[model samples]
Target: MITFPKDFLWGAATSAPQTEGAALLDGKSPSTWDKWFEMEPELFFDGVGPNDTSNVYVQYKEDIALMKKMSMNSYRTSIAWTRLLPDGKTLNPKAVAFYRDYFEEMIKQGIEPIINLFHFDMPWWLMEKGGWEARESVDHFAFYAKTAFEQFGDIVKKWATFNEPLVHIECGYMGDAHYPKVHDFKRAIQVGYHTLLAHAAAVKAYKESSQNDGEIGIILNLSPVYAKSEEPADQEARHKADLIYIRSFVDTVVHGYFPQEFIDLLEENQLLPETQAGDRTIFEENTVDFLGVNYYQPLRVQAVENPRFPAQSPGDFARYYDWPEKRINPHRGWEIYPEGMYDIAMRLKKDYYNIPWYVSENGMGVEGEEQFLDAQGVIQDDYRIAFLEDHLAMLAKAMQEGSQCFGYHMWTFVDCWSWLNAYKNRYGFYRLNREQNYARSDKASSYWMKQVIEQSGFEYGGHL
Candidate 1:
């Protein structure tokens, strides 16, 4: 049996806009998502919008009970900025009361809550005022962060300022798949720099707050970069992609400064983000106490000969090279390489001073999970079980070699609504029965996970 540490955290994760159904209720204004979905209903999957979520805002109590049933000791979720402070200036009393009580219930049930302040759901007004592109959005986000700390910091000790800010930067600004779609690389870099600036400000706010007894960090989807070949250009491609995608955020958050090489590259390309005088001090003074790494796949690339996409974007830095032998999650079209986990841990151990971290998200999202349901009505998700086993075993090996990973959170607890994908792909311990008003039901993986958590380990090679 590969056992984990006694105090290891085991749970799942969720975000607000993806799960909370009451998009515009109780003084909650519309987010960019709400506005965008209204503008282009056809863009979403199966005609589902943010308003048709899993109803976690109303079903959180029952969801907490479901977590307890799954033997989860912790859960990572985000506070909807639109819900808590719709206008981004004033706090809603009802929202504040609901969050306090919600967090209290989770804590009371022995499930520690790692509450994140933002999860890509920008307020509609803020987006109207230029979102992360404008310099002023940084200050607005800082104020919002301070407000969150003032309101809920006492109960929510493990605070993450943003979840996967990189995705926000790349997808939203680069004309990819998010809101305010624009293919402006200059604005993208500005967004990236300002987002980090806002992160530093949030960290500073957390440190200055009275309830400063806990850690403040950022969750980044850090994918390991691999060279497609031994050629010098391919190796350069790997380094460039790594710097742009992984190190650009990890180094700033952990090492407390923007990478000089990346800065130089941007400057040489005339893509450097405009910076203020005192911004350097905020970043240098308030580095993170820990980090949340979200791993889904690794980057395999070669030198940019022919870019993958026509637009000039980050993907152009190192064009993806298809590897014949790479295994892929056919449902999601993402490569499946469990070795990336070990690589991530070792890199953190060897380079980042072995700072505290956790696998904030690692799970498989299979299309049509209900097709796996057996005669007993329990979804037999053996594919998901194998995915977890492979990743966890790799993480265990990394731990034996001295990786400072504290927990492992699956991508989601309930098959919550994905942003544009809606409920097309399911990644949950408990399947969300959409046809029956999002009723929850245990899956075969849930039963298997309970045994793993109860035993603190599992015999993986044998059948359960």
Candidate 2:
């Protein structure tokens, strides 16, 4: 029998914009997502946009009761900035009262609330002002952080300043994958720097303020990069990939400074952004008390003599290459190697002073729900169970090796709105029925996860 430590945190994660459906209610202003859905609904999959989400804003009480049924001791959720401060200036009393009630209800149900301040839901007003790329936006974020801390700090203890800052930089600025898409390396670097600064500023505000018992941190989606082969070129490519994807933000948050290699890369390519005199001090002075790691997949890279682009020349930029064929995950597009999670944890333990950390997000995304359903309206998601079991085994091995991993929280509890994919990829333990009263049904994986949460660990059960 594999038994976890007594203090293990077993919970599920949900972001406000993804789960909350009352997008326009309670004096809520338009967030970037709200605006994007209105202007370009074509970007969404199956014509299902952000406004029509899980409706958890109004159904949270029922959801909490479901969580109790799953025996979840903790729950992770984000606070929509627009919902809290409609105009991004004045605080919305209704919003505050609603969240306060929510938090108090969770506590009353014996569930710990892990509140995240931002989860890719930027207010449209701020985005119009250049978002994280502008220095003024960082000040606005700090103000928002202070406002949230002062208002909800009495009940909420675990605070995550930002969720997946690297994703925002890479997807929104460097690549055209996410909303407000632009392909400018220099702007990406600037946005990345300002994001780190914003996180540090939020941490500083949380620490200096009257919230003494609250623990503050940031959520990072750490995708461990691997080389296709043992060749020197492949190894070099792996290092570059790691620097670009993982270390740039990890070093800044963990060590309170940017990685010198990253700075050198930016400087060499003439892609370095303008930095103020006191920016370094702000970053160095305020480091997080903990870390939230969202591990989905690994990245496989290979060296390239001259990276190719569709355009002739997009100015000086740091470029590496991807070898998609060398790595594979047939089930999902992402590369699935459970060992990567172990390597990430061990590396963090060795290099980053073994900071207190937890698996904030890890799960499988299936294309459809038919594979898991029976004729009697029950869904048996055995594949998801196997996927999670493999990852949990890796996490357990890491824990045995002295990695200070506090707990594991899956990608979500119920099917929620995925940004651009809309509902293309479902990653939930509970199957949500869009047709029938937004009714939720427990999958086989959900039952398995409940047992795992009760046991806190897994034993050898080969393909059970």
- Best candidate, lDDT-wise? 1
lDDT of 1 by residue, 337-385 (tens): 9999999999999999998999999999999778899888899998889
**Total residue pair clashes for candidate 1:** 0
Q: What's the alpha carbon RMSD for model 2? A: 2.5
Per-model root-mean-square deviation over C-alphas: 1.9, 2.5
Q: Which regions of candidate 1 deviate over 4 angstroms?
A: 306-311, 462-464
Q: Candidate 1, residue 191: CA error in Å?
A: 0.4
What candidate 2 gets wrong by more than 4 Å, as runs, is 308-331
Go through the candidates in order and give each one's C-alpha lDDT.
0.90, 0.83
